[model samples]
Target: MKNVFSGDFTQGFPFQGNMTGNDPSGFPFQGDFSKSETQVKPQPEIFETNDFVYVKLPMPNKDNKNLKLQHTNHQLILINYPKENEQSKYMLPSPVKRKGTRARFLDDYLEIQFIRLDESNISEIDISY
Candidate 1:
């Protein structure tokens, strides 16, 4: 007779009790996760100051040329090279000007700043009854 479970260990156990959950072809990798083609979205850190709202996102060794950033008064969308896309929206602590927002990528982090608008300058329009 021949050993039924001795053909290939990488192909998973020949029995029905396979618990590795890997492909029957043995994990499809020798043993390295960095080589995976899947893209993971990066998280961001937000902060507020007296005059500005800031957002910082970490992305290591990524070139700035491939970075794309877009925003509205309350929402932001970001995308980095090779299919990494992330988006977020927040109720700002206060109102921002929304016209002079600025951003830059430095030290493996993307930092964005939006200038706050003075509420006192906003005029209230009285409506007629």
Candidate 2:
């Protein structure tokens, strides 16, 4: 007589046939079964003073040679940083001018400064009924 549950079907199951203590399918028996690849993104700090809006980003293991930075009136974009073919964007706290933008990388951080746009120039439109 032979055992019914002692065949090839139970080879990969826990505490079963062969008892070799290894999964032949290359899968772990317990803990952290996630098989997906995950990427970590850097977070940037943005603030504004009376004259300038500043954005400071943590950029570890990076240099100016491969870093690309761009911006518009309300957003800042970083490219080729943290990893190749990857990009990140940061929103500015206040609107900034197109000109007089400056950036520097120091102490494993990227600091950008932009001139704040004049809010007084905003004009109110009257609603016509």
Candidate 3:
């Protein structure tokens, strides 16, 4: 089954539950994750109720309070800039209205919430007419 993210990829590339080691020939990929430079961003679990849109961003070891949330042109922009590195950006899979965009920091993660000012509906914005 696909995840909330949609698409077959949501099922993820099937893991053996505790299997390590890849193709010795390295046909597809190489390098061990145990010694990798950067890591793939973990997908956060987003829960939507009748009143608000909850987006949980998983980022650790940084001051989450510094993170910012804003909406421009109806797109939810999450800017997380670390003091020692460049700023990171994540896009909400679904469009978010700017009506009431706010965020909270807890447990090293940033929880952004958007108020459903215009009902929990997806409106397609088409400027080409």
Candidate 4:
């Protein structure tokens, strides 16, 4: 018998799943990961020429008006509110300024521009800084 444990086709090394079928019984999150599983990884494009950081959120089919942008002394919070999604808030991973920030609503996408001031920003105010 071919050792399933030592073979590449086995579920030991590159494990696909224990089930033979696509729809596993006990396993969850097999399909439909476009929603509720992961948030659109915020893509921040720093426009040094314009002194503004253009942020593009990859939230497809989501209402642009529902998106909210807020910044604290610690991190830049990008809150995305989908009309069809449950109500909740998400804190951003980076610290950015709230002031001078602008947002625009596009086709099912929200494009925001965070003005990077030449002066001290929220990140600079960190205690460790």
Clashing residue pairs in candidate 3 (N, C-alpha, C atoms within 3 angstroms): none
The lDDT-based order of candidates, best leading, equals 2, 1, 3, 4
For lDDT, the strongest prediction is 2
Model with the higher TM-score, candidate 2 or 4: 2
**Cα TM-score of candidate 2:** 0.66
Query: How far off is residue 46 in model 1, in Å?
Result: 0.3
lDDT of 4 by residue, 1-129 (tens): 257445554444444454433456434445544436656544543332446566555567653565565665334555554443434333333444568777775664567666555555355454773
**Cα-based lDDT for every prediction:** 0.65, 0.76, 0.59, 0.52
Local lDDT at 73 for model 4: 34
Against the true structure, what is every candidate's RMSD?
A: 13.0, 13.2, 9.4, 8.3
Candidate 4 displacement at residue 68 in angstroms: 2.9
lDDT of 2: 0.76
TM-score of each: 0.51, 0.66, 0.51, 0.40
Worst 10 residues of 2 by lDDT: 16-25
Per-residue accuracy of model 3 over 9-96 as CA lDDT, tens digit each: 6245554333444453433345675526555455676776766777787667664465565665334555554433445455544455
What is the model-wide C-alpha lDDT for candidate 1? 0.65
